[model samples]
Target: MSISLSIHGAAHTVTGSCYLLQSGRTRFLIDCGMFQGSKTLKALNYGDFPFKPEEIDFVLLTHAHIDHSGLIPKLVKHGFAGPIYATHGTIDLLSCMLPDSAHIQEMEVSQLNRRNVRRGRPEVTPIYTVQDAESALRAFSPVTYDEWIEPAEGVRARFWNAGHILGSASIEIELTTGLDSPRLMRLLFSGDIGPEVTSFHPVPESPQGLDYVICESTYGARERPQMTLASRRDLLAAEANDALKDNGVLIIPSFAVERTQELLSDLLALAKERRIPRAPIFLDSPLAIRATEVFMDHADELEDGEAFRHAMRSPLLRTTESAQESRMIERIDGSHIIVAASGMCDAGRIRHHLKNHLWRANATVLMVGYQAEGSLGRILQNGTRAVRIQGDEVKVRARIRTLDIFSGHADGTALTQWIEDRGPVSRGIILVHGEEEGLTALHDRLAKKGLDGDRIFAPELDAVFDLLAESPSKRERPAPRRLQPEVVGQLDWHNDLSRLWLDIEEELEKAADDKARRVVLRRIRRALENERS
Candidate 1:
């Protein structure tokens, strides 16, 4: 029997994690995630899936992060009717997250259609609706950690705690290859490994001794300083104290799931200790508020569970559920904290808050999550003097601060250690879910550690491989890809155009007189004409 594996997403970039495996007569997917990052990547979210959805047997979800599980509703909307196997915690989070994702798309598309109408362009529809997300919810089948299950004939799989989020997991599979000889092939998919020390869970764990292992390299090129819980909280308290001084609004663009809850717990702890002022902290995103409730329900499984529960219920923590309430936050007059979602500031209420407060020198934007390349958050982090937000150019006078201590993924050193712990693999290690920098760094690090360089495979998007018993072999492309592998993580032309426009405006403003400005404009026009010719 021949078994083949295909990289659908998260191969050359850190978003849209998916893998398709085909064995004998069975075909299944590891994850059916949505694409996030540059416009070129996000465009894939609206395009057709490379494979037929109806032919997929089932889906094995890694976690509830939109980058990993966002496109499930779209899959269901198309024709997939198979059950989605996930942990109970993942299911609970997805129950709210999927619908929230659909609603956001619906709202954004509706607003976009209005603009399109004025421009006389064709109307565009959302990829999936709230009803479609509701329909997808019915297909979830919960499973427990460390339990083995057979989703198809000759296939046995088990889930291990990845410790990245509330219910994140790394999957292990055992496949029967030869019926007469009765041979077994083992593979492990390391879904986003977490740091060694975190407030919510323990270090990531998984079984060793596999034929082939697929690992995520989200932070494979960067290394973070080791920090204990108290130390991490101390850093947060300091940042919060400094930002809240002189009646400033501290805006933390946070992830809705685990990151928000973790920050809330730490902030409340600091306030109780009198380390930071007990300013009213507003949870402004409806999706984050709902996710926090799920965290509260599962507090018993976390470290310092009682403290987390207590922190979540504190009077200083105010959750704004309605759009009107969220808008009302801008009218407040005192120093406070606002925790909003879409951590990368690519979408959600964070954009609205940034637009309202970015021009104010008294405001501070504390980024607590990883910002992908070309994301609005990255653009700000790069110190752009002015940014285009929601069709308005906003001057960036607000202070931008980044706290790397709050990342959910393990860093380079920790990722190397995690891979070392999953030892003695006979076949190969396939690296995915990262950009070229991360993938190359991890590969070199592994090679320096005496692992054969040839055994480490970093496949591009849509690349196929024949998963042989001895070693996996890369196969020729069966079809052309939706995107070139080179364009996966880099800034697209849209980002370039935005930067170019900003430069032109800055040059015009710098001109001494109208004549000088006209000269600059004439030169630009000549350049454009030359390019056209």
Candidate 2:
């Protein structure tokens, strides 16, 4: 018997969430995601999987966010025929999201390949296609809240409403794995906990004592996120009023899922109350329009969704067609708000709007979501007055503003409060899903109170730790960039056939005969030949 956990992704960085757990011969993986952000990291999207895809037994998804679920199509293409577990709502969102992600991949990869051709370099390909995404969608297995869904022989799991997003869940897992027998252990995975006490949903209960808990710290070091739903409501009203005075466009870059819905609902309330001057609001991005509709379908998950009990209210101003998006952008009247997707301003119609509006002093640019480093949104957030959009240098004269309210993640104080409420239990703590600075801040704060003996650990990318397996003779793990010698040979870095002899010698040391070892060597050489030509 053995127990091991491998951090496949989302260790040092925020995106590409994945981890593998093993008990005896059965292997389970959680959150197979695509990496986003910088080019170097983005290339991980095209990497050869560390393990054989066919060997994977199951996949547990956290939600439908691209960073958390975008790689599913690639997994399916690689021959993974396992059950992909998620909530019903997540399934709906994925139905909309996965196809869109593939579309973006195609657009981006084709552009990159064009540049590669110009530079006399090898052309890269999209990891998967739209058809692959369709195939992957067929593998979804939906589970409800508080229901135990067993994955393997010794693992029992259940999902709780995390209130982070529609159908987002915090999972509780019980694993019984022993070096020689069965030993019980409890584990909890926080699936992107929500904005505390927002206008739409109530904050969920802090998951309590367990043998081990894997909690996310997305905002572990920040102060209450600097915004709330109440403040955001007021801000929206005030901004709309100000923009009405000037009669200019208000461009909002928002995530397609919950954030877009929250903004629309807030705007709808303002429209009903006449709190601000009335103007036609544009809900651009067909994907967002579809997502908002899906959100409304899940009224049972919303707190104010019950407000419909008093009187039925429309959720968001969903523009159904691309023509609507174009018509609004082309001929928008004074001071109207326009919301679009690819929240980072890195892509989408927002780019067109920024090019159209950024130079005007009367126009306003409002940011609502967390912009990762290197995105156009971050440049705007950092107070850059001018930036490039679509290869053109554009001046930024619009009054840049931010209302970080409507966060779906719990902040530092909330993380602390949740931890304290969980009562004294096991001391071992593993901090995940945070930047280095944020994780350090939380670690120091927890250190002061001595909760659970401060066994806090933030594992490195690809780090391996075995809690139940006996420590083997100390051997350094291979670097991630180094896969098989065949992969290395494909680079044409080693022309000599015997270049890999030493490593092969060590690898086949325990073989019974030289004949068997030579066969293995021949197979590796053949694989190298395939990759090269």
User: Which candidate ranks first by lDDT, i.e. highest?
Assistant: 1
lDDT of 1 by residue, 201-286 (tens): 98788999898899999889998887998999989998998899999999999999999998998998899888999899999999
Per-candidate TM-scores read: 0.98, 0.83
Query: After aligning candidate 1 to the native by TM-score, how far in Å is the CA of 472 from where it should be?
Result: 5.5
Error of 2 at 286 (Å): 1.7
lDDT of 2 by residue, 256-285 (tens): 888888777788777777887667677777
Query: Cα miss at 256, model 1 (Å)?
Result: 0.3
* Superposed Cα RMSD, model 1: 1.3
Let me know the TM-score candidate 2 reaches against the reference structure.
Answer: 0.83
What TM-score should be assigned to candidate 1? 0.98
